[model samples]
Target: MKRFCFTAVSLLVVPVTILVAGPAGNGECIRTPKGDITIHIINHATFALGWSNLTIYVDPVGPQARFAHLAKPDLVLITDIHADHLSVDTIREIITDKTLFVVPPAVAEQLAQPLCQRSTVMTNGQAATVLGIKIEAVPMYNTTRQRLQYHPKGRGNGYVLTLADTRIYISGDTEDIPEMRALKDIDIAFVCMNLPYTMTVEQAASAVREFKPRIVYPYHCRGSDLEKFKALVGTDLGIDVRLRDWYNK
Candidate 1:
């Protein structure tokens, strides 16, 4: 097991600054009624959450060393069967006997036997509690006619996790569809924005404005302009736009 030592740094507005050793530089902490939920950014479309002595890895992909600093996950969530979002090799390297999984049916179909046995297949609008966290699978797909072939509806899922009553949303490869715009009471959201794969920054921003999560992180953004996304969201809405280094190697 890898051990981590965290030092608290000072940020003017937020009370805490997370300094940890890893490829994923600094972490952002969300103070919840129970404790702090630490977000460790691994790379595009991948992140790890630390809360309540358990680690939750979201769409874990890439080399095993990329996650060396983090603990083996108590739970892993696979959103889709796409290469970036699901990797059997990476999962095999990190999981232990106790690791649980929540995956979409499409993703579950692709998992190896051991992993499939540990997974709970959830479709859009399905809700279940795993490892003390309430997970609701939300629909994720493309709306534009040209992009329909990329991510067909009902094939993938966007996840909403309720941790200590703090609701978090992770948009797993999607466009700004009605489901995204209809989300309510979302505390934190990780939205995706790219070229033909997902919606543009403008479309992403427009959807965010409508749903109005308290904190929004523009993740899964490979080549999009994050500053423009932030500018479009603006401060008038009182949404905290956190720009993290999700593409760093």
Candidate 2:
């Protein structure tokens, strides 16, 4: 009986150690009042959202990206035709017959052949439901006069995904637009802040503060000061500013 007891304890110890040492896959699963969400940051402006097995890839790019390890996406959303946002090669590599492609009109126009068949076009303010998730296309554009032509309003989109009562905003590539500030009841937000195309760190923080998402992940901030973002959200509004390794090796 004592031998059997020792053997049982040894088996439990091995499993526990493996669990403790295992790679904490992708991003942590966040439990909000609405539902559970797992965010996988792939690089600047690229991420995968997993709610159950229905994975959603947003702005997938990066030549070295490996989707083999990731859950097969039921739907993929491309905000624009920018190289960082929509790479035809990358999309072709990851797309399966079951995958549904969602994109703005500008991106839709660029699609060819079979890809066009699976594509859904959405302009600003339009809404569509795919794979049990409701997607609202919000305006994403440059307000700066010099950069106005980069992303004209109504040409690109920032998506608002409503999944199981949770409202998640993905600011594709935009400045601190009025629509962003006007948003309410946002559970999670993935806001972008980079120079030449989108808002600065200050602008991103200000917009986030106005909307007051329960949690905000500062993504697509390639050449911006992310520390400033954390400092801006420090201890006031109770907004959780999560920092993931979306950049660097």
Candidate 3:
């Protein structure tokens, strides 16, 4: 991979307000043209972000004992039925009468009674508009033959959300599939990298190099060398890598 050659002066200036919102704390929002995108990092593989009244909680599990400050999600997205991604107890705690729950079919089957009433089931290639945000479901899975059964093709989904003019991609548990590399004009991306569940740091960096995004946040990456991830992007791609301490445990 070629080292990033752009000078510091050439890089686009991200406003101080956007960066001031430290990884920890409430009301720490990133102001965008669409609205304020506030992020709260609870712990490993669990975080919450809200934009324009549309709150999105991803993989909302892990140490539920400490998430008292999290607001109820307007939209909850569960990528899979894994305990880290789908905690019935945590979902139940945050769910309200109006929350629009989005999950894969596997997860939807796990829900019982009233929780199922307010949920939307989406598979790969499906899409829906929830709270004015256009959500498109894309395929997410592993290509390595041995690991194919973990996340079979066409069973799970990675989401691409278009909010106002910003396009964001949230890669659920997946390897560096061709479909992800073919994505065009992605403004922001939240990618995953972990062993035995998702791609390696090199694979994630290669995918980002192909489909460049304005900004990239590496989350849901546990027990992996994140410095390698940052170095790969800094030395190979034009994509700006924003590091957040989501896994400080």
Candidate 4:
């Protein structure tokens, strides 16, 4: 039930807090109209969000044991077909009979039997409502001409999930594209920044400034400079830039 406190300083990287003050829980909390949402960062692009009795897992991969400390998921969202984003083994280990999935069409093609049956395929710019949350599949891809093959437009998704009155944006793997820069009224955002795949830290910061989320968390950043990212998204914008240990696997 604890919340993170931020100052008016230009750049702040608050340490990750264990919301329930226990060894099993490791995440930060965000207040919503319905209840508090806990963000559990498992690793790279894998994380879980818990609000009320519902839990949503995003890009769950790696060993099943990696997710031992988090709450089970009621909904699962796969952003792309990359190995890190979609793993049949991890899904099999965590899914229950009642679990549902929301995925891009490319990701859906890779799922088998039951998981496929339980999934709803969403294309870029499409919207759906699941488990009381408004889900919008935003475009995520590489912008540079040479890097276009890494993540072609319409192949992957960046999600915009509206929980109660709070809006959360999860950038799967992308560059600073027009769609990302045009986002409006976002409460929390989880953006990606890594070379040879996603954008550079400078590009990521520029995109964040355009959208201006109240709180922004740099995630899926394997080797990008966190300090530079925080500085680029300066205090003048009144944006709270959080730097977490995403590679703490």
Candidate 5:
């Protein structure tokens, strides 16, 4: 429900003062052929995606007040079962009867009966056309044996949303897996990079270099060095490495 604002901010990777929107330096709205897609970078992995009148909230894991400025979502996508990615209390407060909960199997199993009834469970490689949008569940897991328990291969998923002609990939907690590197026609990608939980900055950069998305935004990078990530991601690879403020209290 908040009004949109426009501004140009200089980022380390892109020299031309990238165009960004909204009060927070993190949020930006990208114009498309159909309509503009507004990315509200709430915090950490939590963010809201808006196009036209429809709103999609992804991994809303923070306090209720954090979401107060945004509009009530028509659809909510919970990537994984982790608390940082799925907050039960936060869902209860924001979700209405009309709101559809799109979640993975593990999350659907833990949800209450009423909430579970309103939810759609999608496994890896499965595709669902919900609310006029095509959502495909992609594989997400840790490659290292030590971090395997953090995110099992088939237990969770990363989602690829085809919003009009633009295909956006929201990577759930995952390492630089082969599946991620194999993605095609990805216009915008939100990749994760955190120590012990996900891949390192170098690994993330390497993966993006392989896939070569038009724009890559770094989120869920609480302890990771994003400056190094930007430096590692050269423009010659044809990727825009956007750095956002994900850690602000």
Candidate 6:
């Protein structure tokens, strides 16, 4: 994968090799009239996004080795208090003084004072602007009775980021809740699925089918059958199911 090379002042796009080439590299980028957003799929639920001059890390967890090659984050977004999504050790290793942590209230309550002091807490239906990008906190929870304890309502957050005209939805550990199915005009969506923890592949596909994001990438899915997900929501429905290697070798 090529390095994310762009200048905020110049807005110059380097050669096609710059950021994941034409959907054939580590990730993809969308160039809109206002700016560009490049997505880097790290591991698990962790992802690094390059938008203009800012580097945004979402649900970043795991070892420091997983993120050695990337730029230091300008902003970090934590969706839940789960260890997989929010790691204080990992945060200590990657964050700088300027890196602001964006999290929901549930996550805020669980974080230590050092983290909370620098964190911006947003609740469901709340919006905030960080690094000139609009971020809205959406609720993520389990609608299924048995799985309710795994993720109760208002405990975690799914997020919608508006970059130029593009809207990217990041589904933090959740089932097929009404909030997810009710989203509108999502250009890119990162959805989670697995047994016992989140939704099944069928549930993930069903939510994606209803929302109809232009492109959908299934992440945080270890044991779930992605092939079945693709078949269930075929291209005929006009939704592109993008399969990425979210788990390590």
User: Each prediction's TM-score against the native?
Assistant: 0.89, 0.87, 0.85, 0.89, 0.89, 0.88
Clashes of each: 0, 0, 0, 0, 0, 0
Better of 2 and 6 by lDDT: 6
CA lDDT of each prediction against the hidden true structure? 0.85, 0.79, 0.74, 0.83, 0.82, 0.81
Q: What is the C-alpha RMSD of each candidate to the true structure, in Å?
A: 8.9, 14.3, 10.3, 9.7, 9.2, 8.1
True lDDT of residue 240, candidate 3: 73
Q: What would you estimate as the lDDT of candidate 2?
A: 0.79
Clashes by residue pair, model 4: none
Assess candidate 2 and give its TM-score to the true structure: 0.87
lDDT of 6 by residue, 52-113 (tens): 88889998898898888788999899999888998888988998988887888777776677
| lDDT of model 6, residue 3 | 21
Q: Highest lDDT among the candidates is held by which one?
A: 1
Total backbone clashes of model 1? Answer: 0
| lDDT string, candidate 5, 1-249, tens digits | 222211112111111122333443444788776677889888899999987788899998877889887889899998998989998999989877888877888887778877776677788887777787778888989999899889999888799887877788899999999999998878889999998998899999999999988889999999999999988988797687889898784
Decoy 6 TM-score against native: 0.88
lDDT of 3 by residue, 61-127 (tens): 8555656666678888778877878889877776778887777777777877566666677777777
Span of ten consecutive residues with least summed lDDT in model 3: 4-13
Residue 75 error for model 1, in Å?
0.5
lDDT of 1: 0.85
Candidate 5, TM-score vs. the true structure?
0.89
- Where model 3 places Cα greater than 4 Å from the true spot, the runs are 1-28, 235-237
Give lDDT tens digits, candidate 2, residues 1-249.
111100000110000000011233665676644445777778888998887568899988866455666877889999988898988888878878888877887887777756766766777877777777777888999999988989988888898887776778899999999999998778789999888889899999999999998889999888888989889877689888887778773
Report the C-alpha lDDT of model 1 over 1-249, residue by residue, as the tens digit: 221211112211112122222332456677665677889889999999988999999999999999998889999998999899999999999999989898887887787777777787788877777887888888999989999998999999899888876788999999999999998888889999999799999999999999998889999999999999999999999888989888877
Number of clashes in model 4?
Answer: 0
